[model samples]
Target: MADPPPAPWIGSVAPESVLWPGVRGTQQAAEWHNAPIDFWFLPKYAHLPHPVVPDENIGGMLTQLSATLRQRLDAVPPTPPPRRTRPGERQDNSRLKTYRTRLRPNTQQMEALRKTAGIVRWTYNRAVEYLKAHPNASFHDVREHSVTEDGLPLMNLSWVTPVLYSIREQAFFDAHTALRNGLADVRAGEIPNFELKFRKKRALFSSFRIRTRDWDGGCLKIPNFSLGPGQHQTKIQTGIDVPSLEHDGACIKQENGSWFLLWQKDMGEEKMRVPAARGPEMCAIDPGVRTFATIYDPLRGTAAKFGDGDHKRLFRLDTHLDELISGSTQASAKKKCYRMRRAANRLRARIRHLVDELHWKLRSYLKQSFDTVLLPKFNAHQMSRRGQRRIGRKTVRAMMTWAHGRFRSRLNEAMEVV
Candidate 1:
């Protein structure tokens, strides 16, 4: 069939600027100029049918939306976007995508969320303490007796509305799970120093994961918070107290100043029946220390290589922390501890960002560009051993510290598309 002609734009604005769903001030939608209005929702919206409900019911509503709305939406341009990879950018075949958006919160709403986090941290700690005291406590017993009348008085805490919020249930499970795992680890001789960890108020991130059922488009409907009116495209019937979320899969991160919600929507080949044969064959994937990875196909005479990250700053930070700890008095020990933790956090963040980026890019590039990725499994523990005195200290440390397990998992996720 012959397709409709492309929609006309007024000046720099899109044809249906006011009504277009994919055009917005978001990370993903910022590239709307690259795709036609008809192809606007192609990547994310490909799963959905034409109508949310019956056509007749929505027909009257559609008529109300300007007369040229359907024409504007349906018309397609000749060329499609993302034809080839950019010089440096990596692509993946993974269907899961996360959408993040800022939240507009007043003072009260922010505090309410913080309180929820505090209660969760407290609950987790209390569970650990109970398990420690009673060595023979079963998982069921720990779950039951973790939050009780005689202990932490979690039931008496009037502020914690456990019934209204679904995160409360997850928090309860997290506490129970932590104790169970800690005990099991102790039994396995994992924690040699009798070091069952405890959760502290300063240590927890002030964000809670929502159940999939509770999450609607852009907004999370928790018990206390409400998704108020005067917002954009809020089809969900929620109050002002609810917080608007972006995507699912990603967690709700409470930053230094305010809360930012990161969400992800998983895309699948089974659901979409997307063909992998559209791309070339990739024979081997080598996760290298020199570069991040090396992909080669002898038959095609083509190769793809990913670069490694420089973690010198992390080692420098660790050295600084060690220096601060050694030759220090008891009075300055607490200060040194704080310094060490802060440095460790920065190091962790750096590693996490680099590794995650590498994983995402490599996985995506392989998925879109290759039909199949053949990977030979290597034992990370064996490869990551500390070198003998023959090697330099830096080289030995590098071997000891590389996170090969995480790298493997990322490769696995990216290749699981088919």
Candidate 2:
């Protein structure tokens, strides 16, 4: 069949200026531009057949929408995305594998790590302010303004010492990367352009990168900090044998008051093996607020639903967080602030773990049952923002917590998804 001519300003239009036709509110109609084939209800005026229900039965827009939805539900799934690489190409010996081992740093070593991280936060904030004034300035400009030729510190960093030179240097590099990446995202229309904010110590204090030269056997040497017997060094708690690494490592402090080291090391190549053949079955997944996923198999004439089953616990945690965060205007003790922060962090960690477990289980089920999984483009933001048909605040909260993007990632890992 002869295809219709493409639109004139399709490729050239800026994302913000483009007007989408059928998607009532969101600019997500642009999502269809990347697809090669057409689908149901797109553009709202495609020459598609109507549902079996008579026109007389449809009274309002809601009824018409329900009829259209039924038609869409019965339609065949669209084509799957093209695979990026062959099965075994992802984990070749040439690639580096990252290991996150817990660190058992003593009180002195822990203090030193915290101090270094604080300095990094300070340095990065300074760099952000510098970029605000001189938009074209690079990391070298900040470095020059912050320190002297002989490496003596300048720029309000009275706590800076000669031993912490490496930490300072790495901080500048990180700050530069952050600014560059943020600007790139702005240009790409993924994020709106705005004034950069300082990195707050209260926020998830990002990890500080250190060179991997300190890794010796199962011990990591801490710079600047002194150990009683020798220079500061900490043992990594892991059963696996530590391999020689050639990159930088990051020291991260977890929410539960634990420290860990994220190290990347090259694992040797393995023999390429083809993946097992998948069964000839397909299913459609509809993500909803109440259920984690609603599965429909037209071939088998059956349907199923899955739920996280952690609703009660999650609700309790949410209520606790709300109580802790309320009444921020009044003066509160440091003890109260500490308790609130601890509760919030623990809740965040628990939610993250639960979501991971849920997705993992869904992936296992999809891999076992279906050769192809069909996932609709679900925009929780758009769903919640519907003007007249907007969901309740509680429902919106539950839907947002589903983390649809993470679920898609899990499906991609083990299943053929459309």
Candidate 3:
């Protein structure tokens, strides 16, 4: 049978419009635009009968596309717009294929899903390790050693073997093909030892399977994987507002505790078509040690503060963990250290949660109060300069380890930082 036609392209409103006022007079103004809807080809092997595509293939495709676009821009001249379509040129929806489904997996299914993910991770890492150990070997030769009927270097876990086979049979060849073609241009002598790593957790089973269509008063039926065997199947029907592809939807583990599925209907390619309203006022923010965040709202002409106590609490937790570690006897030290580590982890998680909450609160306030948000483009290395100048060398090193850059970036996005 012939391949399916490309998914329909939908028109979408600009998201940047919501914050346009703050960026109106600045260079950042150029960054805002109507969200463009373009034709994105679904992978040939990603059809329902097929399993999920391999990470390496996806990563290589992205890498190759980036390089190609970069080179194309350098070589091509700017072009003028084409003429508008005549009245008779429009196509009918009758011939189009539109799919909408709600997906949900039970508890046992969630475990199966996790196993599939773990298998993929192991495969990619094993491939990379093989390449490193055998630099002289080509990817094709390495694949021979790395992959089995189920996948290369099989895991100790036995139950998910079928899933592994599905991935290997469906995606392994395509992934290898993409990777080989992508790296073909690299000079043999200049081959980098390191492989490019894609964001793993976000990419796993990113594709969604259609469940029931137009169920639950037009809400897509989504699976609840967290429910156990007795309560395994529950459907969530999110109203017509389709979930964005980039947005992380709720995932519940299935009854078998292996498979996972998206808890909502994916908006898919239609997300870009929605219209965006202009944002509120603009603000300038300074994030630092003395102040978690110092915000200067241009619209209101006022500053706000957040995250003041986080650093102190983090320090206290660290000191306590250190004291616990230092005093524990060697015989019981390992268990004591584990407890301390767990406590420290919990404390750190709490701090992170607080930070996230503060970020959202500040963003919400700014969105309601201002049109734009401005923030210093801070480099953490530069911020650590003071520590290097005044504090001991080791102290400076320690200070540099904190996620100052990450926090600033998160805050900047929240406020639409230019």
Candidate 4:
């Protein structure tokens, strides 16, 4: 309406001048890309307007504005500006903290962990099956049948004898909880129906919790495992310090042929420390599919964008992965299949890594400035529907891959949300 709020950051600034570097420019360009269709066309023409539509004198002005913005965008570097390092301070003060690191488990340890995960899955499925067959059975009945029968412990079961007793118990409890919650949701009319199904052989990742008691100084002691003492301990990625003595528990999981540990801790007396005073007091962010976020600091009348050119890279990776998947399906040899599988995994990881890196960059920006952040009332389903109908399928695909829900959640973690 009102001339689209006079183009956030470009009001009186000459097009020839360099504004804020990478992130800000890329995001502003994203806004420019949508300006014609969203702001001008629908309102003025009531139809999709061509890029160079002939409208009275306004058309020429729009053309010049578009060209100048393009030239400015081309002059700016593609890569986002380097992150400014913060001076040493107590940054991590959350009461509960989670530390994640890539696990470097030797062949023996990997085999052991794999076996332990299998056993856990088996225990979970067994419990669920029992519950389904005996719908009125209590959790105790399910637990007793799963962990023990006739005074014989789970260890007596050949399949469960290899791993620690606690792991199996944890899996059985998890299964019972899931079934109970599902039933509750069905009764509450929150879900149309529920079904208990077994974990398939193929899964995105396999994970099981290791009790604190099971650890022998980094090493997980599994019965009859070949490795002895230190030889079986999974090593964390270099430079990450795991709080050996204070960690509450650990979950080990395998992701795309790589192992990782999610270590948890309770920060007994630590609390959230106030972030140093910097930047603006508050900023309103318009999260988008093409741009990570377009942020406007009303007090300063300045705008900046956060996401680097990650969506483009993600699309390329997605296409490459699709090709790899197609090739893998047609391959007859084991070697080809293995190679394709590895390539696909690498692609998936890269896509995931890019999104995570963008989120962290956003979080860092929030922490360093803007004491209070405001996010629009987002309805993802409605957005998707409107985007597909108005913007086309390609735009809708990007919207879906934006991981907006995850982005919002990470923002919540970083600061107070309004």
Among all candidates shown, the one with the greatest lDDT:
4
Ranking by TM-score: 4, 2, 1, 3
Per-residue lDDT of model 1, residues 154-201, tens digit only: 545565544234455455455555555565677789785454577666
Model 3 gets an lDDT of 0.41
Q: Rate the local accuracy (lDDT) of all candidates.
A: 0.50, 0.57, 0.41, 0.62
Error of 3 at 102 (Å): 18
lDDT, ranked from best to worst: 4, 2, 1, 3
Off by over 4 Å in 2: 1-108, 126-135, 147-151, 154-166, 180-193, 202-204, 212-219, 226-232, 238-256, 260-277, 281-283, 294-305, 329-335, 368-371, 386-389, 416-418
lDDT at 341 for candidate 2? 69
**Residue range with the least summed lDDT across 10 consecutive positions in model 4:** 39-48
| Model 2 weakest 10-residue run by lDDT | 40-49
Candidate 4 on 1-418: residue-level lDDT in tens? 2433544444443341233223333233323222232211111111111122245564455456445544543453455454322222123434566777777776777777787788888888888888889877876787788766442354656667667676677777777767777888899898999988898656656788776666555555564665334553343332355536254346777887788777766645434333422223555577777776777553443566555345676677677888999999999997888778878888888787777776776678676776656576555667577534556666666766677888887776565332
> Better model by lDDT, 1 or 3?
1
Local lDDT at 9 for model 1:
26
Candidate 1 lDDT (Cα, 0 to 1): 0.50
